[model samples]
Target chain A: MTEALASAATEDILREAAAWRDAGRGVALATVVTTWGSSPRPVGSQLAVDQGGRMIGSVSGGCIEGAVVKEAQDVIADGRPRLLDFGVTNEQAWEVGLACGGKVQVYVERVE
Target chain B: MKRDLLDSLMQAQRRGTTCAMLRDLKTGGQGLYINGEFTGDFASGPNLKPLVLKAISEDVSGRLPEPYQDIFVQVFNPPVRLIVVGAVHIAQALAPMAAMAGYGVTVIDPRRAFATDQRFPGVTLLNEWPDDGLEALKPDRRTAVVTLTHDPKLDDAALSVALKSQCFYIGCLGSRKTHQARLNRLTRMGFGEADLARIHGPVGLPIGALTPAEIAVSTLAQITQVRRAKPAAPQSAAA
Candidate 1:
């Protein structure tokens, strides 16, 4: 059997975010700034996105990444950050909320 | 996020220095907070630095408290550390187990034969007196200490250092009788009831583990319980 590595550290994601910027790709970093209830990812969990539609890391297990990526690309285009809130109680709950019914505040900002 | 600032933050992170990435939600500006120094476009006054510092030290990442509500402090703490004093069969099982669970494991034993690379390949082996070995490691808030030598000379010295420091977990392997005797010794040595209470005598979840590997699993499981389990009700925060 293959050995399972330890939990992937935040350094790996941040390093990838930095490398993308250095390579001249427009990258946007989405960080889960806050979480309430049963969030799969912790408050500091992140999702890195490039303008090319590639992504790394995650803000939620799998439920909210698509919406966060779309918002991230917008931030990359405008060079202005935006915060997206998702939860069972939100107005856009059905379309983008976490399946685990957790609440999270994701701050998306373009990497300069 | 500025390229230079990200580079500097990564440099600090690589060096195992605690750092925080701060963002002003109102302005969408991001910066790095490392070693009490702020590097970024946003102005971090006296009021903001301590909040970031608190977040880093507490290993909590979230919005700043009242008055500084606009900032989000994202803490990046160094790896959680585990120091096992003994390097015996239990340690041989425990060291790699703890490492797999994301703890930076260090095994301390003055006996070179016990603390060797043959037994512990990637684990940090400190073949010094337990107290001296622990002191050199400079146990911090993120550290966990376990004494399994079954020798008071080694276990007591390690306990003295661990109890006095902010390490999150202190476990000593011993039975009820041995634990009571250990407590008596520490009490006589000037540790009060509150200080002595921190030691997890028998040092593992009471699953009646018979083998060294099973004991290691129990100990590591207890460490996880202490590390991840919240002290109070989660309901209040969710509310």
Candidate 2:
């Protein structure tokens, strides 16, 4: 049902993250640690990525997800968490389509 | 984060518990905050005390101040609940309004005709004695209890349960003279002035509300004021 899927999407991102980890795959969680004005996603919005490039949830809605996913892959590989800054002063903000012009700081950490 | 820690957080979420997660970026130290119970790799830091309390109180997620600037606190809270212990006219208006304000509203009345789904559509209806219904509900600190039935038997039974629990707000519909009489009865029933003081006598702000909707607005505004003015987390929790 649509309700079940929607609830899973909104309420179970961490559940999916744990599921992937339990299945013997490396998992990474990308969280919007902080935001400065007009950002699409509020602080604590999260994206979960597995080793095979599969990702669930959205940190920046649509914008900056690809970049976060790339960083998540590196976090999974190195087991070293990363803090990514986007928008305003970051040149990659334009390339990544963080079109809102709001600054967002994302913290990506591997689930070990 | 440890798999066990993630499991703990997931378990709390499943139980509709309010909690928080803290992570130190520099040290990779992680902690979980639950009803002042701290657990995890970084639980022992005294400086994390006030930050965790403030973070959960405001339902905010952000970094700590300098010295522990890299520490991020993420809060998770369940929906607020409002238990209306009557299906009267005020409840009819209040239920929908409180739901719009993001409280999961429930209406309780033993009279089946009054507590009908037709009268209170989309609200959880409980056609049971007030005491039994409230006992089953187990109102937590995020819950608000309001008794609107003028009958002593119904209001007192609900008040007994509401007084014993940690509900953030308690309001009863009555005039000042009626509330004084009610307080006398409750006093004889073993409640002290300290416990009775929690009840908002002649409930709702003194806006001279003439209509049910206006009274509901005043009552909801009073509840909001009470909740905002008090510390969301328990006081004596710093230890």
Predicted complex 2: CAPRI docking category = incorrect
Residue lDDT tens for model 2, B1-239: 77777888888877877778888777777889887788996667665778777777666778877777788888777667899999999999999998776577889999998999899998999999999999999998878999999999999999999999999899999999999999999999999999999999899999989899999999999998986554576668666
lDDT of each: 0.84, 0.84
Q: With candidate 2 superimposed using the best TM-score fit, by how many Å does residue B211's alpha carbon deviate from the native?
A: 22
If you assessed candidate 1 against the hidden native complex, which CAPRI class would it receive? Answer: acceptable
Which sections of candidate 1 miss by over 4 Å? A1-8, A20-26, A50-56, A76-78, B44-47, B188-190, B208-213, B232-239
What proportion of the true contacts does each candidate reproduce? 0.45, 0.31
